[model samples]
Target: MTFDLIIALATACVAFVLSKRSVAHFPLWRAVVTPLASIIGSGFLLLGPILNIGYGGYAPLIMIALCFVAFLFGGVIRFNMAAGEQAIQNGDYGALAIRIETLSSWALAFAYIISVSYYLNLLGAFALSLTPFNSDLDAKLLTTGVFFIIVFVGWSRGFKSLEKMEYVSVSLKLAIIAGLLIGLMAHFGHRALDDALIFNPPKLDGWSALTLAFGLLITVQGFETSRYLGSEYDAQTRIKSMRLAQWLSTAIYLVYILLISYVFRPDQMSSSETGIINMMQIVAPILPFLLVAAALASQFSAAVADTSGSGGLFAQLSRNRITERQAYLLLAVIGVALTWSANIYAIVNYASRGFAIYYGLQAALGAVIAARQNTGWQRVGFYGLLATLGAVIALFGQPVE
Candidate 1:
């Protein structure tokens, strides 16, 4: 009960602090919030258990590796933001850079399609987790309903009204995540003092483990959202905010994975979609409630963001041949199909592959720009390697079993 009270108090304090005008109104913070929110979305709810169950005590290490890979990808995007944009504006790279950029945008639009399904499906699962209607079919039906709502709202009213929910949702989700970390920390300390911490062996090894990590790329996929905030921020601001968002999210993820890895036995981790909620039931009674709240806010907001993004990208890339309304309808149809055809884990894999293809194209574009600009063989080689890696991940990444 003491721990529960502490967790509740911590959450309230963080929420209150985040709601203050100084923090809420800061320009850099506001810019940071978008990508940060997206980056930490449904992944926070799912990755802990997946990593803990799959990698055991080495989960934190795996988390670090995931973040590092994401940071490298982020570096590619950042370069494109700084240099590629200028080159395109000046017509310095001929049509090759322009072509790759177009292909990447199209890839991103498709990736967003998969990712919206990923977010809303998790939202449905978490929404029904504590209720009596807690089955796969129930979750799928709920997800389908939400898809329709998004489509209706988007087509009828536009997402401007719903997009405002992002700020509040980001604050609430971050505050709840703070509380979860505090609870996990206290639990971890207690276990350490009692010598009850467990360091289980990895359940996976070698090539299988490598491919699984590839599939999980979407867990760290949202940093690219920062690259698209051009209308709201300058190139420099976007680059700085993106770097900050990735760093902060990486820190949060590493701590969460580290704390959870040692505190729970392999058997104690739930294998279901809402497994984290059940696992948190042991950490503190308040934790499950807080987690569910965070899950709902983060997932819904992320879905809306991606849906809006997909619509805009499709409309732009198609030269308005596909209106944003038609794109929303297309997304709704595909999202529903995904919800019915695949489980959340499989959707996660598909989303990861989709994003990987987008990142690869971005990397390929970066390499072309670098080569044309005489940016040195080493930099060009790095980008080429990243492009190959992204392609490999897209081709070989497998779903979690």
Candidate 2:
């Protein structure tokens, strides 16, 4: 594990340097890689168990279909970004876009706070679970304290330093997850073959699958972050990046689901908040500790990234009504409060709804863009109805676990 950590850090450092250089020199790299990195994280732990337990052997199929749905949503966001950029270019910064932006920013902030809170709870739980502190309250308190400290550091120093840490955290996270998949392949190769042939599992109702997907919506939401990068990149680049991000993330997630589904018994997996740890423990005792470390790194990186995003959006939407630092701190405080009020699963549900609402706004923006570009009336109606349906699902969908 120690050697693996060193290797992951070294790889991340190199990758970070290359990525920064690419951002400076190559627009394509800037477009492809930046969005790609931002789109994946520890949210998979929550997503995977829920998906597998709900859909059994059919989780991969559901995930594939969901990924395509996410891709369509990504297109909506991309079109919206293009429209916004065009609006700025035409010197028409329209009222509708501004209203949507303001509302989306608030929703995005709410979602990020909830996400941070849930991750803090997860990290605290993983840490304590390794020891004797068995109370959920104790974990929440410890997580709150840790979260506050992270917020203070981020607010004081800003994301410049945090961005540097992201390379390491992201690399460690991907490497650990990949390692787990590889480890599973090695340990259960013959068993996996037999399991594939058997493929016996409980029936998965369509409504249950849809509800589970809605509940886990936040896991696939990182592609939308590219919409916020409009100020940094041109609309074309941002749109392309969003498209690339959705593709890359879809492939990665599909591979992970395939490996884990074949490797682990569906009945053995449960809807535990520490589902990753539970999955890893069944494979090897040491695997949980490594996954815990990876989870901590991923969650910290995610919190810092979202903090920076929410702060920037708040500042932009407010037209400098509040300073970025103040916005960040306020978000952190909200996160801390939320951590005390809900456990990880409840937070997941909140974050799913939060992001779902934000996506609906983006879809509305897509409709506006379609009208402006004089695109087909079909696209206009498609995005319009998608926005309505997304909002409805988010508002009323039941969570199975």
Candidate 3:
């Protein structure tokens, strides 16, 4: 799992740097890159096991279909950045921010609060998973202390530091996961393959596949971070990075799902929070420990990236006059209020819904751009947006419920 993402992420970084081009417009590359940090955490761990088991047999076919959905997600990254820039060019950044808040509503704030808390839990899970070569309460307390320490450091560090931190943590998690998977495969050998090939396929047909696709949609839905990074890059670079990284991530995820499916019975996988770790346990119990370590790395990197990006966005929004320091202060107060009361499961579920809506909003922007013929690949983009909206609505349902 660690090394599994290396090839794709390393490629994304290269593409990110290379995509830079001179343009007098809003920066998007950073925003696009930052979204990756958000997606690679809890969602990645939970999404595959649950969606695959619930909707389809552990088959490569669904993985392939899911890749298309992720591609549409990438289009969303492009749409958000493009639209935000257009709003600025029209001298309406404040209006754009209003539109954003209007679209996201209270659910957006609630979802983020849940996300922050869950990430903290993930940080605790990471340390606990690694705690036994065995220690006791002191060790646990120390780990808890470390989690708070990371949050402070992440919030305080500037963008350069945050990006570097994410790259390192992301790299470490990928390495650890890759090693564990390889180690497990070697130990398990080929015996499981014959049984896996015997394949008790899913019985569902037609529209159910679409619903499954929607569920799978949650897994591979990062790649919007580059848009956040746009201020640091040129326009051509932003667009290219957004497009290439999304497609690349889709391809990588498809391969991962396929290989993992081939290795085990998808139905045998648990849907509990520890599902990914449990799936690895089936391969090798020790793999769970390694995954937990990776999970720690996952949350650390993602939180740093997300918080920093959000802060920058505020600065951008304020610089553009959408909100003031009071808005920022109020948001912080709201976050603290929601903190201790958050239920991990419900928050994560609500987060997925919020993400779907956010992505759906971006898709709407893509459709508008497509209709106007403003960018390369507009027609595909138009359809991509629709597919994403369909998936979001069809799979996760509405936040109002």
Model 1 C-alpha lDDT versus the unseen true structure: 0.89
lDDT of 2 at 69: 71
lDDT order, best first, reads: 1, 2, 3
Across residues 1-401, which tens digit of lDDT does each residue of candidate 2 receive? 66345544554554465546544366755445445554665556666777777777787887887777778888887766766655733546456766776677688867777776766777777667666785788888788887777767777787566666665566566666666655555556766556543343645586765776777776777777666666667777778878877887787788877766655666567677776677867766667776777677667666666766777877876788977788778887888878877768778778778878888887886776676678999999999987996797688656555
Candidate 2: residue pairs that collide? none
Candidate 1 lDDT over 183-263, as tens digits, reads 999999999999999998988999889999999999998888877777778999999999999999999999899999998
The TM-score values for the models, in the order shown, are: 0.97, 0.87, 0.70
Write model 3 residue lDDT over 116-209, tens digit each, in one string. Answer: 5456555654455445633334333543454456445544655677676776566565555456545545534565654434344554556665
User: In model 2, what is the error at residue 369, expressed in angstroms?
Assistant: 1.6
Please state the error at residue 41 of candidate 2 in Å.
1.9
How much does candidate 2 score in TM-score?
0.87
lDDT of 1 at 130: 91
Per-residue lDDT value at 354 in model 1: 97
> Model 3 compared with the native: what TM-score?
0.70
Backbone clash total for model 1 is 0
lDDT of 3 at 196: 38
RMSD of model 2 against the true structure = 3.6
